[model samples]
Target: MIACSAELYCAADLLTRASLGELDVDIVAIVSDKPAAGELAAQHGVPFRLVDGGLAGDSRAEQEAAFAAVLDELEPDLVVLARYMRILPEAITVRWNGRMINIHHSFLPAFAGAKPYHRAHQRGVKLIGATAHYVTAELDAGPIIAQGITPVSHRDEVEDLVRKGRDVERTTLANAVRLHLEHRVLVWDNRTCVFA
Candidate 1:
């Protein structure tokens, strides 16, 4: 598995027990600019490779090249973006295709972008949730695999809502990854039917 964000550490820990050596999913490499992410990889004894350029501002060619370099070196079977905050080029998306997945902070087709917790708070919604889906070029607009929702109250603040949302996010993403690893998710017309 190729983990791209901090939340991936949690996913990795979860996988350690669930796969029970069946997958033996070694975290071949991790890409992040954050020191904490690097530290986590080091603690887990996984090799860390830093992206050479800024993902958001770098040209598509540069980003693709960098991603290709990592793929060449890691040759990961699956790419999991656990809160990695960068848009992937279409070339890479097509190359990896179904082998990639991402976790979003909101039930997709609703709050699909960043600050979803704040968006839910502003809307005064009574429930907030997270979505896990395939990594399509259309940001957060991918086939849904799994989701988890939690109720909010009138007294809840943005931070409180985000805190509650994190738990759901972690569990939902883990479930999605497990299903994908087990080949239990079948995609059809931008939607998913997961066995789990």
Candidate 2:
């Protein structure tokens, strides 16, 4: 299953790959709080679930609980957070453990949270990268499964970094998902041993 926010960039790529029989997994459902995501899932013929507990008086805890319930109902073998902007609650993270994975916009251990491409551009970094890792409670510090980087020059602006970073993110996330599904990734001490 894929849980995402407004942008379905990763999800769209995964769906395309799956439709072409490139991905050897079944996408059970696409769950999100946005109708835009639902529309995307509909276009791909995947089941869509709208579980937004943040409607008016609902608390954050309620939203988390609703999301957890969606997972329980689906009971997916793997959960991929394809740009799911919200930070998952601790209970959900612990319950899912190694079964959940996420794609961060940076190479991780640096600019681990939001707007990583912007940070990379501001620092005049020569390389912008993406990280695919397990979703632990400690933000983006989970065991890294896959990463890809692209070279950038001083002339590259924030938009340029974002464009390059998206490409890396898509491929890296796909590789990570493939590795995990093939049972070729082992985690120890917050790191990964990928036999690839």
lDDT at 91, model 2: 89
Please write out the lDDT profile of model 1 over residues 1-196, one tens digit for every residue.
Answer: 5556545544454445444764445667667644467776676677787664454577656765876788877778888887777788887787887888888899777888888989999999999999988988888898888989999998999999988988888888778877888889999989888785
CA error at residue 27 for candidate 1, angstroms: 2.0
Candidate 1 CA-lDDT value? 0.76
Could you tell me which 10 consecutive residues in candidate 2 have the lowest summed lDDT? 51-60
* Candidate 1 lDDT score at position 11: 48
What is candidate 2's TM-score against the reference?
0.97
Q: In candidate 2, list every pair of residues with a backbone clash.
A: none
Clashes of 1: 0
Query: Which regions of candidate 1 deviate over 4 angstroms?
Result: 5-24, 55-61
Give candidate 1's TM-score.
Answer: 0.87
Best by lDDT: 2
